[model samples]
Target: MAVSRLDVFYRRLLLTKLFIGGWGKPEDLKRIFEFRKIIGDRERCKSLVPKDYPVYINKTEDLTDCQIHDGFFMSPLEHLVPGILPPEAVKARFQFIVPKKWQRNRPVCIHLAGTGDHFFWRRRTLMARPMIKEAGMASLLLENPYYGYRKPKDQRRSSLKNVSDLFVMGGALILESTVLLRWLERDGYWPLGMTGISMGGYMASLAVTNWPKPIPLIPCLSWSTASSVFTTGVLSKAVNWTELEKQYAINSVYEEEIIKLLEYCGADSFKMMPNLLKNVNSLEHLLGLSGDHEVSVSQYSKTQMEAEVDGGLQGYRAGEREQQLSSVNSKGTSLDTVTR
Candidate 1:
């Protein structure tokens, strides 16, 4: 009997998943550590920013215009501070819809948008707005970095520069959410919770993970293993793995050299590379490891997902590892480097 292409692919995927430990036990701390290191530094990534710290409302009356919306210009903390050029700068638009039964002092739910192709408008309308309104809560729709309004017009669509730029934008968005939450607290509006879909879900995970304080986070279609996305069969087409593998290999060879430059700087383990590189060729085989859906239905339960998000947040707060995941500045300084 002849083997079909689908059969070959499934076999390869199973092996790759086993090698990468994608479907392994959750309590495997070693796998968790390896996974985190592969993603570089989540904190150093870019995200959204508010135009103003206070986010002043022009008129109290305008709040009554349930359908009114506006954009505000704000830079993430890294961008605002001099001597730091972390991957990208984030400028986000604030979108809101006032519900008919709006209470003046009700808590607000902020929805962070997801990645690829577009921004958070559809998510805001379909998910965030409806949920917020149903709960009698106000809502704010935050655009992800390198998405919707934040994407540069001159850049080619889905290019490496565009993708890299979005990573930076993601970091900025995290910081922006933190600042916005603080601002809202000052204004007497409690941040009830946050939710995201797809890429937005990724950002929400990072936000809760990196946030200094505990915030209620609900990330739909979330995955704890980012390496799985790059190394798995499903997202192989999404990112140019062939090119990325080359980059990862180059970075691996220079890891020691790079570390020597920042002796005092914090760094994560370097074990994630070998698996990532080894599995690069087997990505197509791993498709059957998980389903076609973005969400990991078989591997992670709802409780498990929530716990992982919480664990990521705790990791950030504890500062168990260094913040600099990659070189963000052209000067060869790591993103986490603090210069006086």
Candidate 2:
């Protein structure tokens, strides 16, 4: 289907407005992605997490579709920075689901959800498991910091106010993912991968960077550079850019120390290329260790600079990334990466 010329003109006009209305200094961008020294730091990877942090499997019940293991882990962030974490973020939560057919050496994808994504929106991930079971893999869908049990009681769904809240979300998720992945490894899940759609993709990217070993990194509907999303995408219209600018000034983003602090965050100057390259190296490692290269790009768009995964073309996502409804009941169907 062809896009209407009027819609293109409207979007271009919106982009123009975005540039003039909200473009902040380069220094301000740092505050968003690197406000915390621990945002993407491998050295601080799970450092806040303690040894033998408890996992409470409060409830486990067998369902018709699959068996669910619902649980929570101690929030390392609360301990790492006293009195700073939101009350709801004090514990990391997760829902681990697997088909009854799950057995040894099955692949597990650490599935992530997008920002403010909760309630009915979660079914998008849960529905993928039957297909995974057909392929003999397991799905571990993690609840992000600001979603599920980690959400503050006062904050509405996906409602994170203040610039500090955003930093806390990123920091907490990065740490939480590390802890979960480590636990999964200890339990012996081979060829594990991380994937998510949109902001979840960004979080997954950050998580893989801190991971020492190579694993699959599939971020559907997301790009290496997030600054563009906040500054130019349709989301810009929803986010309060002026408020963020004021917060930057208050945080002293222009201070020389602040600049140096962010610059120290990476080898790629926080453009996410270092993390992206790390993902590529991990892909090579997966090939050596598992003898299979699974890159499933479910959807593609040229304007987004998204590379094809499984021969996806234009808007037609032609691949077996997600098992079709008919295939779910069929045995021996394998899954590649986590699809949102």
Candidate 3:
């Protein structure tokens, strides 16, 4: 089906202005790279979020269909980043909307802010209010760092000053989401889930991945990764690519060191063939292939695999490392299989 003209127009309109400034300070990204090892591992990432933190509820308003509860907690990033963060961005604010009448399931979904979504107004009026009235579902609208009440005074609109700012926002949200999820669980909220639009959606996905329990995740207008958005999506127009390219060409550290680190850490997707092959058997199950039609990477297509490894044996050997870690299967998959 073809996309409607109105859809095209609105998407363009929404993505018009973003990343106004050039990649602010190349060194800023190095800060993000430092946390890569921890963030890449679920257990390590969860360790960053404190198990105990006080959430101070400041205000409450009784609505016809729901009650709006406002509260905030000190951002965990404050201690992590120390002097790097602006004062205003330290406090994580949120709006919790609970239905007047509780449903039997008592489901509450966390809503994360998307690009240009500065405050709770858009999510509250559009999602939270409607959800509660219709299904008696509750909502917790999280104010992303460098957005809304947490936005730095020096930052202009929602355009983050640095690339690291985006990473920091995601990290903060992941930690904060865990805190909220735990709080909700303690308060007797069952069947918790998370949802967000665009960038918010991506953040929600990341947050959900770190969660130990099974929960519903709705990532609207997002993909498994943000690379496609920056490279080819409508949002690409908003980036200062000329500046990025110019800096990449001139900066030896960014061009050389970053590339080396990414590949060394197995973060480079192109160099992930070994990891891909390790899970190749799972593909058979995914494809619903029977025992009679069993297929291995080599047996499936020798030509395609050979073509991918241009330099023959040396190319295949390069990916093999003694310290490489194997991927763990998700509990959900095992549970589903057992039920079946």
TM-score, cand. 3 vs. native: 0.75
* Candidate order, TM-score descending: 3, 2, 1
Q: Could you tell me how far off, in angstroms, the CA of residue 173 lies in candidate 1 after the best superposition?
A: 1.7
Q: What tens-digit string does per-residue lDDT give for candidate 1 at 163-210? A: 224334444666677666766666677655677776667677776665
* Candidate 2 residue-wise lDDT, 65-144, digit = tens: 67778878876667666545667777777777766765667677787887556632363345456555566666777787
Between candidates 1 and 3, name the one with more favorable lDDT. Answer: 3
Q: List, residue by residue over 236-265, the lDDT tens digit for candidate 3.
A: 555555665566567767655554434434
Q: lDDT per prediction?
A: 0.48, 0.57, 0.70
- For this target, which candidate reaches the highest lDDT against the unseen true structure? 3
Total clashes for model 1 = 19
Regions of candidate 2 where Cα sits further than 4 Å from its true position: 1-35, 43-51, 119-127, 245-260, 264-340
State residue 256's C-alpha deviation in candidate 2, in Å: 7.1
Clashing pairs in 2: 116-158, 135-333, 297-309
